[model samples]
Target: MTNQQTLPLPMALNMTLGESLAKRRTGRAFRANALTDDELSTLLWACAGLTGDEGRRTVPSTLNLKAVSVWVLRDDGTWRYDPAKNQLTRSTTTDCRRASTTHQFDFVTKAPVTLAFVLDHDVANTIRESCFYVDAGTMGQSAYLAATALGLSGCIRASFDHKALGEAMALPDNLEPILMFTVGLPEGK
Candidate 1:
């Protein structure tokens, strides 16, 4: 049976958009500290969580397909964030951070949380591949602002072995990995 972790209500990130924009900067150096459930919830929500009852999102979906999904990877397991439920459904017992990064970026392995942006073809069959990437890119930008507002460090990467990661997460064929956003406490903090 798959275990589900209910995310706590997201903490309001206090920084303004301008402040967050000014503070936002990509950093790959992450301290080996796991994000608290609250932090992860807030970040995930910022990335693509639902905002209204009409099934809208923090980031826009091409033609409102809402096909994008965020997969959370940490030392404990791999999880898929269900925005409708605000919960994470565990997908595997093994950590798949290594598969989420390229050989050149060992720092990714040291980060405590990596969010895999994915596109579900089943939900977006009519959309082109470029649309999938644009949607994911917007979510990545949101994640960067959220991390900065939360006083965390993060970097978005597309250097991972997609095939390896898909297999590691045991993702269904319909789900395609688009990007990886890794976040954690800044190193030396």
Candidate 2:
């Protein structure tokens, strides 16, 4: 475990569902600006944090099994998103952006933030693989909308080197990368 700073997160915005839905778009042009810590906290909370006392999350998980985990990569280092506590725990101090697939937008490496969604295969099981993907898709879309509502640009991609990422992040064999969402300010119109 690495040094971490636990900060309080703000309440969810009052944006209407239609507004969030209409604002949703896959933005590949990300401004080379870092996202504020608060903004990052809000985005992570909106994706999978606990929203109610019963431990209900912002995104629905099948059978109440929160089989997905979020790992964030930034210029500083890699950290794991702990929704239970609404904080980021440092995982590694290496920059692994170059490990991402080349055909992806070239600016990905320069983006301020990248979110990787990891699925717990052990929890999903062979019979629930499809469900896990569906659940992850829902969470990923929520992340996109949340980023949009926060006035940030983001793109959801699934073309990263999973084996390398898993090893670098020190994720258990049961955890597998499902998708990556690169987020930052929009570069230009």
lDDT of 2 by residue, 129-154 (tens): 77877777887898888887888888
Task: Report lDDT (Cα) of residue 86, candidate 1.
Answer: 96
For model 1, the stretches where C-alpha displacement exceeds 4 angstroms are none
Worst window of 10 by summed lDDT in candidate 2 = 96-105
Q: Write the per-residue lDDT of candidate 1 for residues 1-189, one digit (tens) a residue.
A: 558999998999999999999889999888998999999999999989999989899999899887888999999889999998999999898798888876845788899999999889898887688998999999999999999999999999998888888989999899878899999999988
Candidate 1, TM-score vs. the true structure? Answer: 0.96
Which candidate achieves the best lDDT against the true structure? 1
Q: Model 1, poorest ten-residue lDDT window?
A: 98-107
